[model samples]
Target: MRPGYGHTLRYLGAARGAITRRQPIFPTCYGDALQGSPVADITADPQSGWTGVHPAILAMNCLAYDAATLGNHEFNFGLPWLTRMLSAARHPVTCANLKLTCGRFLPPYLLLDRMIRSHDGEKHPIRIGIIGLVPPQVTSWDHLHLGDRLISEDMVKASRELVPRIREEGADLIVALAHTGIDTGPAHPFMENAALQIAAVPGVDALLAGHSHQIFPDSTVPGTDGGAVDSAIGTLSGTPAVMAGFGGSHLGILDLALRRHHGHWTITGHRSEARPVTSMKTGIAAAPDAEISRALTKTHAATLRLTRRPIGHSPAPLHSYLAMVGDSAALRLVNAAQHEAMAELLRGTAHENLPILSATAPFKAGGRGGPGHYTDIPAGPLKLRHAADLYIFPNTLCGLQITGALLRDWLERAASCFNRIGPDARGVPLLNPEMPSHDFDVISGLTYRIDLSQPARHAPGGALASPGATRIRDLRHAGKPVRASDVFILATNSYRAYGGGGYPDLPDTERIHTGKTQVRDVLVRHIRSRSQVAPPAGVTWSFASQPGASAILETGPGVRRHAAELAALGATDLGGGSGGFVRLHLPFDGPLASRGNDN
Candidate 1:
């Protein structure tokens, strides 16, 4: 899928704030326009750095779509902005399945006639009837707004009603634009996705599905008869369905070959491809799409500027890379905030006397957040953007009650962030999501050892290293093994508390205490409570032993400045490699090379 001109337009909006809309907000639904710039607002480009979007959504308007459906991100900007944007769009936005009591289906489906070109250079007109539908689960994403709108009518039932009406209107073919995800394998009752359900609809001939951002190759939906199912427009059963990647990342191209016989057109051949946002001028991977960058440049610059504004002063800069190895400014800040929040929550609660400790991970650490994952908190007044940049996701705060056994399991899961070490090896991989850098568990009030020799017993199913496998052994709190039945209060985000991390026996949602506050608000409150927070006092965790050897992986062009300092401290600095990685000096004598490279 190609990004098309949308991204470029958005970039210009952000650069110049030319769009007549609100400023770009984090986790935005509207894209670069949130940051301001460009000539027009683009529905792609979430400022959080992900590359995904409903491709060429703008083209739907120019193509005079009978009725365009809504995708997941369409609601990302919240209802107000979405309503405004859709109102501004030239084409009518519609969804037969999602409607208000006033008879307006948000954007109701439209009826139209389209012109077509025959292979023989002949032009023809077709009476086509189209309707759009979306999944009901879209409510889960923006529950706040979705709460007000009526979310009833399943896609199947919706299609059954609308398709027949189109046919009655003398339209030859019934088309459905379903905003639903696809899973070809099973038909779980109570799990009626649009694709499978709509396929069974008698009146519909062709279907276009979005919200999955998936590309269908050769335009063929395999059938039980071991042959292609023919449709009025060609091979719509497998021929015409397509979804471009998200965020102006790709463009979906679908071509259909229709034949006329007995005064009716039938689809014969179908093809669909996901093309990149980059240029094909020379070849793939060579010409970076300037339009994409240009579209986002102005907005990107404005976003950076807005985020860079002074926030409340930090005595010590926060960082995630440091947290990856041991303690870091970013983790410490989170830990401090969580600790403060928990402490306040426990002030008069039943668990107040239990020597409370808060656990937090380095979520904003160096991986996807950006190259400079280090939070350089220069001293100053903090703003809303600063808080968002610091905490990112909209996850809520949740506290859980766990037994000592469960706590041990939790730490093991944290340790699992490290890779299984070869007998001759040492140190953990820098980016293990299970033991993901961000998920590195920090136990505030407990101290434990991570014995490298033992296999890591992370998660619940079974011993990840093998029965009795061990990475975390001899778990103790205050110099003694924790009692099995000893109940303790554990604080974590709502996402993990709901079994998001694959940790076992932790699916106890009843133990959860929801906070009406957002995570960023909690951090700001915690920071204000402290009046001043510092990086953790010291390293609370460390490697049991150096890898068979220790290696230094440098990062950034300015890494040399720290090289001499690290080498003098007994480490070797291996020079640079690919992925924007630089060399670091580490005294690693392991079987593996002592060099580290990172993008």
Candidate 2:
């Protein structure tokens, strides 16, 4: 349901056209695209060509959404901007979980009385109740704006408290518009994925879930309990559900057959599915609706001009195709910029003398976004779009005071990106498909080696998996071994510093500095400060020497162009793997260890 900046107006127009043909469209959007910062400042002066959230609001208004919900990214521009956007919408915005401790501009739920055409061509009046839910982590994710002004209760708990009340208010059918994922893992108080739990609630007849940015009814999804999820028949706790992929890639549809019995309407049968705007195998590619495109033409042109504006120049090409293998120019540029910004921000503070370690992850490493998602900018003029591509999210820069022990634990958690490799299992796949690229953080101010032979100390969800296992080795800061008690101010995004990824030992008390500036802005400023930027060349960490051990890494297909550079790293081309990834074989030897030791 999240229509971010990635999709063009043309794409959205095409998606909307498909939705109208099915039924009375109840359009829903899960926020985060009014202003993506350095990428496209939609909030740039009102007199300017950029129309801020006007175009987005107009587009949704044209579709005539029955009701909508706010995603976590809705607060990217602060509560005031969001309040104005909501006010501009023709339809009401419902969010049951978000409590305004100070003031309220949105409703908790909306009841719509609609006349639906039954199977026999008879019109039946039904009261449809819609409730919206956003993740409770929004407070921590956008602490600068929300702080103590907003309070988000648990999704499941909120649904239980509000659903019955909505039902009592003459709601024939209840539809939960949850901005959460459908993770079937163990339930936690503030779990990011609470769709399954919410679906189990008695009054919830149907649900539309989002926020994981992944497709549902996807038969390929494996459950955490070693079971396969029948995503094709999207259901949670026997309740029909749908989760449309992000950026208007797909439109989720849930068709329910209702029956009137005992003076009450109930869902008798339901079918849930997601339709893609463009499908290669089915050979269906629809054109954008002329009306929608015409409406957004001005905003689209303005965004293009702003994104393509030259910011600076890079001496060498920046690409994330090989980021997982070693240090890439794109990641190095982000780390350097974040480090510089944090260093300056902490000046004159108590944390000024503390060593600043910038932690960043490769945003476009080709996993869920597919092969073409990799950031590959040719060496030449660097535009604002390039910097945006380097650091994708709108997360603000923050500094956290963490001990050496916590840092090592964080690295160990990052090391979970790789699958455990046995010494005898040669030619096995190295990267774990479950570990997201964003979770594989790499700190810039330290040197370490990851021992692939050892098991991951933490699981993908950040729980301790192997108690004594140690993947991070040779941990040193400034050529000296860092003790467990050594404290350092880590430069990271608000998400990580606020324990977004369930990182061990980081709490609000540890936060030392929080900057209002977005991280992408810092990257742009860092680039503009210099005429020609060249990132440092070398690998910070590498797999431990396994002698005869060999593993295959899957990356974007574009890696073939850098064959010579990859050969130097002892990686042999093994041709293409499944999806759009090219396989590269790495053979571990003593000489490779020496190359990995370079700072």
Quick one: best TM-score, which candidate? 2
lDDT of 2 by residue, 123-142 (tens): 55778888888888888878
Candidate 2 residue 416 C-alpha distance from true site, Å:
1.7
**Model 2 Cα shift for residue 346 (angstroms):** 3.1
Compared with the true structure, model 2 gives a TM-score of 0.91
**Candidate 1 residue 372 C-alpha distance from true site, Å:** 6.7
Residue-level lDDT tens digits of model 1 in 1-599 = 01121211000011111222221111101112121111122232244343322223333343333345565435533566566556645545567776664567564445666555444444455566667776654454344345557565677777777777777777755666666545443444323244656755787655665444333332333433433333222233443454443435444444444555565655544444545554535423435446555545654555565555444557654444344454455666776677667778878777776654567776544432223443444445665466665665455676777888778777777777655545465333434322334456677656555544555665321235454655654555655667878777777665456454445435445454656355666887766665566655644454454456443443443434444334433544455533334544433332122221110
* lDDT of each candidate versus the true structure: 0.50, 0.75
Candidate 2: residue pairs that collide:
217-231
Cα-based RMSD of candidate 2: 4.5
Error of 1 at 63 (Å): 11
